[model samples]
Target: MSTIEEIQAELRALTEQEDEINESLDALLQERGVLEDQLASLHKLMPNLGLIHNDAKQLTGMISFTSQLADNVSGKVRQLDLAKSRVLAASLRVEDVLDLKFCTEGVQTALHEESYEKAAALIHRFLSMDEAVLQLSEDAAEGSSLKQSFTTLHEAAAKLRSLTHSKFDSAVNSGDVASVERFFKIFPLLGIKEEGLTKFAKWQSAQTSTQIEV
Candidate 1:
Protein backbone atom coordinates (compact mmCIF):
# COMPACT_ATOMS: atom_id res chain seq x y z
CA MET A 1 0.00 0.00 0.00
CA SER A 2 1.08 3.59 -0.55
CA THR A 3 2.32 5.71 2.33
CA ILE A 4 -0.12 8.08 4.03
CA GLU A 5 1.01 11.03 1.94
CA GLU A 6 0.67 9.04 -1.25
CA ILE A 7 -2.75 7.73 -0.31
CA GLN A 8 -3.99 11.17 0.62
CA ALA A 9 -2.80 12.48 -2.73
CA GLU A 10 -4.57 9.65 -4.52
CA LEU A 11 -7.77 10.26 -2.60
CA ARG A 12 -7.75 13.90 -3.60
CA ALA A 13 -7.37 12.93 -7.22
CA LEU A 14 -10.19 10.40 -6.96
CA THR A 15 -12.69 12.17 -4.76
CA GLU A 16 -15.50 11.76 -7.28
CA GLN A 17 -14.81 8.05 -7.59
CA GLU A 18 -14.80 7.58 -3.84
CA ASP A 19 -18.02 9.48 -3.46
CA GLU A 20 -19.76 7.45 -6.12
CA ILE A 21 -18.53 4.21 -4.62
CA ASN A 22 -19.66 5.19 -1.15
CA GLU A 23 -23.08 6.23 -2.32
CA SER A 24 -23.55 2.96 -4.14
CA LEU A 25 -22.66 1.01 -1.03
CA ASP A 26 -24.74 3.12 1.35
CA ALA A 27 -27.93 2.86 -0.65
CA LEU A 28 -27.65 -0.93 -0.71
CA LEU A 29 -27.17 -1.13 3.06
CA GLN A 30 -30.19 1.02 3.77
CA GLU A 31 -32.30 -1.10 1.42
CA ARG A 32 -31.13 -4.28 3.11
CA GLY A 33 -32.04 -2.98 6.54
CA VAL A 34 -35.51 -2.11 5.29
CA LEU A 35 -35.88 -5.57 3.82
CA GLU A 36 -34.92 -7.18 7.13
CA ASP A 37 -37.65 -5.13 8.82
CA GLN A 38 -40.19 -6.15 6.23
CA LEU A 39 -39.19 -9.80 6.62
CA ALA A 40 -39.75 -9.59 10.38
CA SER A 41 -43.15 -7.98 9.80
CA LEU A 42 -44.12 -10.79 7.46
CA HIS A 43 -43.07 -13.40 10.04
CA LYS A 44 -45.37 -11.79 12.58
CA LEU A 45 -48.24 -11.59 10.09
CA MET A 46 -47.86 -15.24 9.07
CA PRO A 47 -48.57 -16.49 12.58
CA ASN A 48 -51.70 -14.39 12.86
CA LEU A 49 -52.84 -15.51 9.40
CA GLY A 50 -52.32 -19.17 10.39
CA LEU A 51 -54.59 -18.78 13.44
CA ILE A 52 -57.35 -17.09 11.44
CA HIS A 53 -57.22 -19.60 8.54
CA ASN A 54 -57.50 -22.60 10.90
CA ASP A 55 -60.34 -21.06 12.94
CA ALA A 56 -62.43 -19.70 10.00
CA LYS A 57 -65.47 -21.81 8.90
CA GLN A 58 -66.07 -19.93 5.62
CA LEU A 59 -64.42 -20.56 2.15
CA THR A 60 -63.72 -16.76 1.86
CA GLY A 61 -61.34 -16.97 4.80
CA MET A 62 -59.18 -19.62 3.05
CA ILE A 63 -59.04 -17.59 -0.18
CA SER A 64 -58.09 -14.36 1.69
CA PHE A 65 -55.30 -16.10 3.58
CA THR A 66 -53.83 -17.61 0.39
CA SER A 67 -53.97 -14.28 -1.47
CA GLN A 68 -52.30 -12.43 1.43
CA LEU A 69 -49.57 -15.05 1.69
CA ALA A 70 -48.84 -14.85 -2.03
CA ASP A 71 -48.55 -11.07 -1.95
CA ASN A 72 -46.34 -11.00 1.10
CA VAL A 73 -43.98 -13.73 -0.13
CA SER A 74 -43.52 -12.11 -3.53
CA GLY A 75 -42.88 -8.68 -2.02
CA LYS A 76 -40.47 -10.08 0.55
CA VAL A 77 -38.36 -11.84 -2.11
CA ARG A 78 -37.96 -8.63 -4.09
CA GLN A 79 -37.00 -6.69 -0.97
CA LEU A 80 -34.50 -9.37 0.07
CA ASP A 81 -32.74 -9.17 -3.27
CA LEU A 82 -32.51 -5.39 -3.07
CA ALA A 83 -31.15 -5.62 0.43
CA LYS A 84 -28.53 -8.15 -0.65
CA SER A 85 -27.24 -5.82 -3.36
CA ARG A 86 -26.88 -2.93 -0.91
CA VAL A 87 -24.89 -5.02 1.55
CA LEU A 88 -22.50 -6.17 -1.20
CA ALA A 89 -21.85 -2.59 -2.30
CA ALA A 90 -21.28 -1.47 1.28
CA SER A 91 -18.69 -4.21 1.76
CA LEU A 92 -16.73 -2.92 -1.23
CA ARG A 93 -16.80 0.67 0.05
CA VAL A 94 -15.56 -0.48 3.44
CA GLU A 95 -12.53 -1.93 1.67
CA ASP A 96 -11.84 1.37 -0.08
CA VAL A 97 -12.11 3.36 3.14
CA LEU A 98 -9.77 0.99 4.94
CA ASP A 99 -7.17 1.32 2.19
CA LEU A 100 -7.25 5.11 2.45
CA LYS A 101 -7.24 5.04 6.27
CA PHE A 102 -4.09 2.91 6.26
CA CYS A 103 -2.37 5.55 4.15
CA THR A 104 -3.44 8.29 6.58
CA GLU A 105 -1.86 6.39 9.46
CA GLY A 106 1.49 6.37 7.64
CA VAL A 107 1.55 10.15 7.10
CA GLN A 108 0.57 10.83 10.73
CA THR A 109 3.46 8.64 11.87
CA ALA A 110 5.96 10.59 9.74
CA LEU A 111 4.79 13.90 11.19
CA HIS A 112 5.23 12.53 14.72
CA GLU A 113 8.92 11.94 13.93
CA GLU A 114 9.12 15.42 12.37
CA SER A 115 9.73 14.03 8.88
CA TYR A 116 8.97 17.24 6.99
CA GLU A 117 9.79 15.69 3.64
CA LYS A 118 7.11 13.07 4.00
CA ALA A 119 4.70 15.50 5.60
CA ALA A 120 5.14 18.10 2.86
CA ALA A 121 4.28 15.77 -0.01
CA LEU A 122 0.60 16.68 0.08
CA ILE A 123 0.01 20.42 0.16
CA HIS A 124 -3.61 19.64 1.06
CA ARG A 125 -2.52 17.93 4.26
CA PHE A 126 -1.00 21.22 5.40
CA LEU A 127 -4.55 22.57 5.63
CA SER A 128 -4.61 20.69 8.91
CA MET A 129 -1.49 22.52 10.10
CA ASP A 130 -3.32 25.80 10.71
CA GLU A 131 -3.85 25.24 14.43
CA ALA A 132 -0.20 24.40 15.00
CA VAL A 133 0.93 27.23 12.75
CA LEU A 134 -1.27 29.93 14.24
CA GLN A 135 -0.66 28.90 17.82
CA LEU A 136 3.08 29.03 17.19
CA SER A 137 2.89 32.28 15.20
CA GLU A 138 3.99 34.26 18.23
CA ASP A 139 7.77 34.53 17.90
CA ALA A 140 7.99 34.86 21.65
CA ALA A 141 6.52 31.37 22.10
CA GLU A 142 7.35 29.87 25.45
CA GLY A 143 6.63 26.24 26.19
CA SER A 144 3.03 25.49 27.02
CA SER A 145 2.31 24.77 30.66
CA LEU A 146 1.82 21.13 31.69
CA LYS A 147 -1.90 21.83 31.80
CA GLN A 148 -2.28 21.82 28.00
CA SER A 149 -2.41 18.82 25.67
CA PHE A 150 0.35 18.15 23.09
CA THR A 151 2.81 19.95 25.38
CA THR A 152 5.87 18.21 23.92
CA LEU A 153 5.21 19.00 20.26
CA HIS A 154 4.12 22.50 21.24
CA GLU A 155 7.28 23.09 23.26
CA ALA A 156 9.43 21.63 20.52
CA ALA A 157 7.71 23.87 18.02
CA ALA A 158 8.36 26.91 20.18
CA LYS A 159 12.05 26.16 20.68
CA LEU A 160 12.12 25.59 16.95
CA ARG A 161 10.70 29.07 16.40
CA SER A 162 13.25 30.57 18.79
CA LEU A 163 16.16 28.87 17.02
CA THR A 164 15.10 30.08 13.60
CA HIS A 165 11.92 31.20 11.89
CA SER A 166 12.20 28.04 9.81
CA LYS A 167 14.06 25.67 12.10
CA PHE A 168 11.59 22.79 11.75
CA ASP A 169 11.72 23.01 7.97
CA SER A 170 15.49 23.18 7.84
CA ALA A 171 16.14 20.29 10.21
CA VAL A 172 13.49 18.08 8.67
CA ASN A 173 14.76 18.92 5.16
CA SER A 174 18.21 17.71 6.16
CA GLY A 175 16.70 14.25 6.85
CA ASP A 176 18.95 13.44 9.76
CA VAL A 177 17.50 11.70 12.81
CA ALA A 178 20.35 12.93 15.01
CA SER A 179 19.57 16.52 14.08
CA VAL A 180 15.88 15.85 14.70
CA GLU A 181 16.71 14.36 18.09
CA ARG A 182 18.93 17.35 18.91
CA PHE A 183 16.12 19.69 17.91
CA PHE A 184 13.77 17.81 20.25
CA LYS A 185 16.19 18.10 23.16
CA ILE A 186 16.45 21.87 22.81
CA PHE A 187 12.70 22.40 22.47
CA PRO A 188 11.07 24.41 25.25
CA LEU A 189 9.29 22.92 28.30
CA LEU A 190 11.21 19.64 28.38
CA GLY A 191 12.23 20.70 31.85
CA ILE A 192 8.58 21.37 32.75
CA LYS A 193 6.13 19.06 34.49
CA GLU A 194 3.81 18.59 31.50
CA GLU A 195 2.74 14.96 30.88
CA GLY A 196 1.64 15.99 27.37
CA LEU A 197 5.28 16.09 26.40
CA THR A 198 5.76 12.62 27.75
CA LYS A 199 2.75 11.43 25.76
CA PHE A 200 3.94 13.08 22.52
CA ALA A 201 7.21 11.23 23.02
CA LYS A 202 5.35 7.99 22.45
CA TRP A 203 4.27 9.15 18.99
CA GLN A 204 7.93 9.95 18.27
CA SER A 205 8.94 6.45 19.32
CA ALA A 206 6.27 4.90 17.11
CA GLN A 207 7.46 7.03 14.20
CA THR A 208 11.05 5.94 14.69
CA SER A 209 9.99 2.32 14.73
CA THR A 210 8.12 2.74 11.44
CA GLN A 211 11.01 4.72 9.91
CA ILE A 212 13.07 1.55 9.71
CA GLU A 213 12.86 0.90 5.93
CA VAL A 214 13.15 -2.85 6.33
Candidate 2:
Protein backbone atom coordinates (compact mmCIF):
# COMPACT_ATOMS: atom_id res chain seq x y z
CA MET A 1 0.00 0.00 0.00
CA SER A 2 1.18 3.62 -0.61
CA THR A 3 2.25 5.82 2.41
CA ILE A 4 -0.79 8.20 2.04
CA GLU A 5 -3.29 5.27 2.04
CA GLU A 6 -1.68 3.88 5.24
CA ILE A 7 -1.95 7.35 6.91
CA GLN A 8 -5.68 7.59 5.99
CA ALA A 9 -6.34 4.08 7.46
CA GLU A 10 -4.58 5.03 10.75
CA LEU A 11 -6.68 8.26 10.97
CA ARG A 12 -9.92 6.23 10.61
CA ALA A 13 -8.78 3.87 13.44
CA LEU A 14 -7.99 6.91 15.71
CA THR A 15 -11.51 8.28 15.12
CA GLU A 16 -13.08 4.99 16.30
CA GLN A 17 -10.86 5.01 19.49
CA GLU A 18 -11.91 8.67 20.26
CA ASP A 19 -15.62 7.67 19.98
CA GLU A 20 -15.05 4.75 22.50
CA ILE A 21 -13.19 7.06 24.92
CA ASN A 22 -16.05 9.66 24.75
CA GLU A 23 -18.60 6.88 25.50
CA SER A 24 -16.51 5.66 28.46
CA LEU A 25 -16.29 9.26 29.81
CA ASP A 26 -20.10 9.63 29.51
CA ALA A 27 -20.64 6.35 31.50
CA LEU A 28 -18.19 7.43 34.24
CA LEU A 29 -20.00 10.78 34.60
CA GLN A 30 -23.38 9.01 34.97
CA GLU A 31 -21.94 6.67 37.66
CA ARG A 32 -20.46 9.67 39.51
CA GLY A 33 -23.91 11.38 39.50
CA VAL A 34 -25.54 8.27 41.05
CA LEU A 35 -22.82 8.05 43.79
CA GLU A 36 -23.28 11.79 44.60
CA ASP A 37 -27.04 11.32 45.06
CA GLN A 38 -26.50 8.37 47.47
CA LEU A 39 -23.91 10.37 49.43
CA ALA A 40 -26.40 13.29 49.75
CA SER A 41 -29.06 10.85 51.11
CA LEU A 42 -26.59 9.55 53.71
CA HIS A 43 -25.81 13.13 54.73
CA LYS A 44 -29.53 13.87 55.25
CA LEU A 45 -29.85 10.87 57.69
CA MET A 46 -26.73 11.73 59.81
CA PRO A 47 -28.47 14.15 62.26
CA ASN A 48 -31.33 11.66 62.92
CA LEU A 49 -28.82 8.84 63.55
CA GLY A 50 -26.97 11.02 66.06
CA LEU A 51 -30.24 11.86 67.86
CA ILE A 52 -31.19 8.16 68.05
CA HIS A 53 -27.80 7.24 69.54
CA ASN A 54 -28.12 9.91 72.23
CA ASP A 55 -31.68 8.88 73.04
CA ALA A 56 -30.62 5.21 73.40
CA LYS A 57 -27.90 6.23 75.86
CA GLN A 58 -30.35 8.28 77.92
CA LEU A 59 -32.90 5.42 78.02
CA THR A 60 -30.28 2.94 79.19
CA GLY A 61 -29.20 5.29 81.97
CA MET A 62 -32.83 5.80 83.08
CA ILE A 63 -33.43 2.02 83.24
CA SER A 64 -30.29 1.52 85.30
CA PHE A 65 -31.28 4.31 87.73
CA THR A 66 -34.85 3.00 88.06
CA SER A 67 -33.58 -0.50 88.84
CA GLN A 68 -31.24 0.84 91.52
CA LEU A 69 -34.02 2.96 93.06
CA ALA A 70 -36.38 -0.03 93.21
CA ASP A 71 -33.74 -2.14 94.92
CA ASN A 72 -33.16 0.56 97.52
CA VAL A 73 -36.88 1.03 98.20
CA SER A 74 -37.46 -2.71 98.59
CA GLY A 75 -34.57 -3.00 101.03
CA LYS A 76 -35.93 -0.10 103.08
CA VAL A 77 -39.41 -1.63 103.20
CA ARG A 78 -38.00 -4.92 104.48
CA GLN A 79 -36.06 -3.07 107.16
CA LEU A 80 -39.17 -1.17 108.23
CA ASP A 81 -41.13 -4.41 108.53
CA LEU A 82 -38.42 -5.98 110.65
CA ALA A 83 -38.33 -2.94 112.92
CA LYS A 84 -42.12 -2.98 113.27
CA SER A 85 -42.13 -6.62 114.32
CA ARG A 86 -39.48 -5.95 116.91
CA VAL A 87 -41.42 -3.01 118.33
CA LEU A 88 -44.61 -5.08 118.63
CA ALA A 89 -42.78 -7.91 120.35
CA ALA A 90 -41.19 -5.52 122.79
CA SER A 91 -44.56 -3.92 123.57
CA LEU A 92 -46.12 -7.30 124.29
CA ARG A 93 -43.27 -8.21 126.63
CA VAL A 94 -43.68 -4.95 128.52
CA GLU A 95 -47.43 -5.45 128.87
CA ASP A 96 -46.94 -8.98 130.20
CA VAL A 97 -44.43 -7.81 132.78
CA LEU A 98 -46.78 -5.08 133.96
CA ASP A 99 -49.67 -7.54 134.29
CA LEU A 100 -47.54 -9.96 136.31
CA LYS A 101 -46.48 -7.20 138.69
CA PHE A 102 -50.02 -5.93 139.11
CA CYS A 103 -51.44 -9.38 139.85
CA THR A 104 -48.71 -10.14 142.34
CA GLU A 105 -49.27 -6.93 144.31
CA GLY A 106 -53.07 -7.23 144.12
CA VAL A 107 -53.07 -10.82 145.40
CA GLN A 108 -50.81 -9.92 148.35
CA THR A 109 -53.00 -6.96 149.29
CA ALA A 110 -56.22 -8.95 148.98
CA LEU A 111 -54.87 -11.81 151.11
CA HIS A 112 -53.60 -9.42 153.78
CA GLU A 113 -57.02 -7.77 153.94
CA GLU A 114 -58.73 -11.19 154.23
CA SER A 115 -60.59 -10.37 151.03
CA TYR A 116 -60.91 -14.02 150.00
CA GLU A 117 -62.98 -13.41 146.87
CA LYS A 118 -60.58 -10.74 145.61
CA ALA A 119 -57.56 -12.94 146.36
CA ALA A 120 -59.13 -15.89 144.53
CA ALA A 121 -59.96 -13.73 141.55
CA LEU A 122 -56.36 -12.50 141.39
CA ILE A 123 -55.09 -16.06 141.64
CA HIS A 124 -57.39 -17.12 138.81
CA ARG A 125 -56.08 -14.30 136.69
CA PHE A 126 -52.52 -15.34 137.47
CA LEU A 127 -53.27 -18.94 136.57
CA SER A 128 -54.70 -17.87 133.22
CA MET A 129 -51.37 -16.30 132.14
CA ASP A 130 -49.04 -18.30 129.84
CA GLU A 131 -46.48 -19.87 132.16
CA ALA A 132 -43.76 -20.16 129.49
CA VAL A 133 -44.13 -16.52 128.42
CA LEU A 134 -44.07 -15.40 132.08
CA GLN A 135 -40.91 -17.43 132.57
CA LEU A 136 -39.28 -15.71 129.60
CA SER A 137 -40.29 -12.35 131.02
CA GLU A 138 -38.83 -13.28 134.39
CA ASP A 139 -35.58 -14.30 132.78
CA ALA A 140 -35.34 -10.98 130.95
CA ALA A 141 -35.94 -8.98 134.14
CA GLU A 142 -33.04 -7.20 135.87
CA GLY A 143 -32.96 -9.41 138.95
CA SER A 144 -35.05 -11.99 140.85
CA SER A 145 -37.83 -9.49 141.59
CA LEU A 146 -40.24 -11.54 139.52
CA LYS A 147 -39.10 -14.71 141.24
CA GLN A 148 -39.67 -13.16 144.68
CA SER A 149 -43.07 -11.95 143.62
CA PHE A 150 -44.02 -15.45 142.45
CA THR A 151 -42.83 -16.98 145.72
CA THR A 152 -44.84 -14.42 147.72
CA LEU A 153 -48.00 -15.19 145.75
CA HIS A 154 -47.54 -18.95 146.23
CA GLU A 155 -46.98 -18.53 149.98
CA ALA A 156 -50.03 -16.27 150.32
CA ALA A 157 -52.18 -18.84 148.45
CA ALA A 158 -51.04 -21.68 150.79
CA LYS A 159 -51.62 -19.59 153.90
CA LEU A 160 -55.10 -18.58 152.73
CA ARG A 161 -56.01 -22.20 151.94
CA SER A 162 -54.88 -23.41 155.39
CA LEU A 163 -56.75 -20.55 157.09
CA THR A 164 -59.97 -21.26 155.22
CA HIS A 165 -59.84 -25.01 156.05
CA SER A 166 -59.16 -24.44 159.75
CA LYS A 167 -61.85 -21.72 160.08
CA PHE A 168 -64.43 -23.89 158.30
CA ASP A 169 -63.69 -26.83 160.61
CA SER A 170 -63.76 -24.65 163.72
CA ALA A 171 -67.01 -22.97 162.66
CA VAL A 172 -68.64 -26.39 162.02
CA ASN A 173 -67.54 -27.68 165.47
CA SER A 174 -68.95 -24.60 167.21
CA GLY A 175 -72.33 -25.02 165.44
CA ASP A 176 -72.08 -21.46 164.01
CA VAL A 177 -74.38 -21.89 161.03
CA ALA A 178 -73.48 -18.47 159.49
CA SER A 179 -69.68 -19.06 159.59
CA VAL A 180 -70.06 -22.65 158.31
CA GLU A 181 -72.12 -21.58 155.30
CA ARG A 182 -69.81 -18.67 154.43
CA PHE A 183 -66.61 -20.85 154.57
CA PHE A 184 -68.29 -23.64 152.58
CA LYS A 185 -69.02 -21.33 149.66
CA ILE A 186 -65.39 -20.07 149.74
CA PHE A 187 -63.95 -23.66 149.58
CA PRO A 188 -64.72 -24.15 145.87
CA LEU A 189 -63.10 -20.78 145.14
CA LEU A 190 -59.99 -21.93 147.02
CA GLY A 191 -59.89 -25.09 144.83
CA ILE A 192 -60.74 -27.54 147.68
CA LYS A 193 -64.11 -28.78 146.44
CA GLU A 194 -64.05 -32.37 147.70
CA GLU A 195 -62.70 -31.49 151.16
CA GLY A 196 -65.31 -28.75 151.54
CA LEU A 197 -68.11 -31.18 150.59
CA THR A 198 -66.86 -33.79 153.14
CA LYS A 199 -66.66 -31.21 155.93
CA PHE A 200 -70.20 -29.99 155.12
CA ALA A 201 -71.59 -33.58 155.26
CA LYS A 202 -69.95 -34.12 158.68
CA TRP A 203 -71.51 -30.92 160.02
CA GLN A 204 -74.97 -32.03 158.78
CA SER A 205 -74.57 -35.43 160.46
CA ALA A 206 -73.51 -33.83 163.75
CA GLN A 207 -76.52 -31.51 163.67
CA THR A 208 -78.84 -34.49 163.05
CA SER A 209 -77.30 -36.45 165.96
CA THR A 210 -77.78 -33.44 168.34
CA GLN A 211 -81.41 -33.07 167.24
CA ILE A 212 -82.06 -36.82 167.86
CA GLU A 213 -80.45 -36.56 171.32
CA VAL A 214 -82.54 -33.49 172.27
- How many clashes in each structure? 3, 0
> Which residue runs of candidate 2 sit more than 4 Å off their true CA positions?
1-96, 137-139, 209-214
The positional error of residue 14 in candidate 2, measured at the CA in angstroms, is 82
- lDDT tens digits, residue span 1-214, model 2: 3699999999999999999999999999999999999999999999999999999999999999999999999999999999999899778877766776887899888877888778877766665667576677556444487777677767766777798798888988787899999888877766677988998998899899999999
- The 0-to-1 C-alpha lDDT of every candidate, in the order given, reads 0.54, 0.82
List TM-score per model, in order: 0.21, 0.51
Looking at candidate 1, what is the lDDT of residue 179? 62
List candidate 1 segments past 4 Å from native: 1-13, 55-214
Could you list the CA RMSD of all candidates, in the order they appear?
38.7, 12.1
Q: How close is candidate 1 to the true structure, as a TM-score?
A: 0.21
Model 2, CA-based lDDT: 0.82
